[model samples]
Target: ALLGDAAHPMRPYLAQGAGMAIEDAQALAQCLSVGNAMVPEQLQAYAQARWARNARVQARAIRNGRIFHAQGAVALGRNLSMRLMGERLMDVPWLYAGGSEVHGFNGNAL
Candidate 1:
């Protein structure tokens, strides 16, 4: 399966491209380890498992770019929110922590 830039090329705003690539490799390895499925079936399963999560990450990266490039009042508000929330605002538990249910995969490796 495609990993890193081959799978989803995203902006560096979220700093997750490399991390996602690593996760993709791990997930793909796990999918391949199943051993019962054909190559095409395994790949389809990998795509199904990763599509949503990758899409979300890509979208977040784009959104973060916009937020980071914000000007005037928007920038002011963004800075204020960051200050108010501190590390909590930047901490994405769902993205970092596992437990997401992806089709064709039963592990929390992602």
Candidate 2:
């Protein structure tokens, strides 16, 4: 399974965490939809697509956490960056616009 941080996860500075996870699941589904047909090649394809993306995320998260925890100037910069993005962040429609792709057990796509 895919994994992210165990503790002190970075905020989605680029608004990617959940989206990335959804994309991962979707991509995995696309890769693994063998239609009752399983084979070594299918598994290999899924691994090929997902592993690189997962590694990129892990690397980015570590870098972001370091930036957030860096010395005074860097920490200040991080905070300032948050403030600069905060307003647009709150209003971004993807944060709330529920859709079918975010499906749930009740058939709610959100």
| Predicted structure with the largest lDDT when compared to the true one | 1
lDDT scores in order: 0.79, 0.53
Q: Give residue 2's lDDT in candidate 2 (0 to 100).
A: 42
Estimate the lDDT of model 2.
0.53
Per-residue accuracy of model 1 over 44-110 as CA lDDT, tens digit each: 7777778888889899989999999999999999999999998897777878884244445444443
Candidate 2 C-alpha lDDT tens digits along 23-103:
556755754565543656545555555555555555665666677578888879878877889766335464344322422
Residue 107, candidate 1: how far off, in angstroms? 11
> Which pairs of residues collide in candidate 1?
none
Model 2 Cα RMSD, Å? Answer: 8.4
Residue-pair clashes, model 1: 0
Error of 1 at 44 (Å): 0.6
Q: For candidate 1, what is the lDDT?
A: 0.79
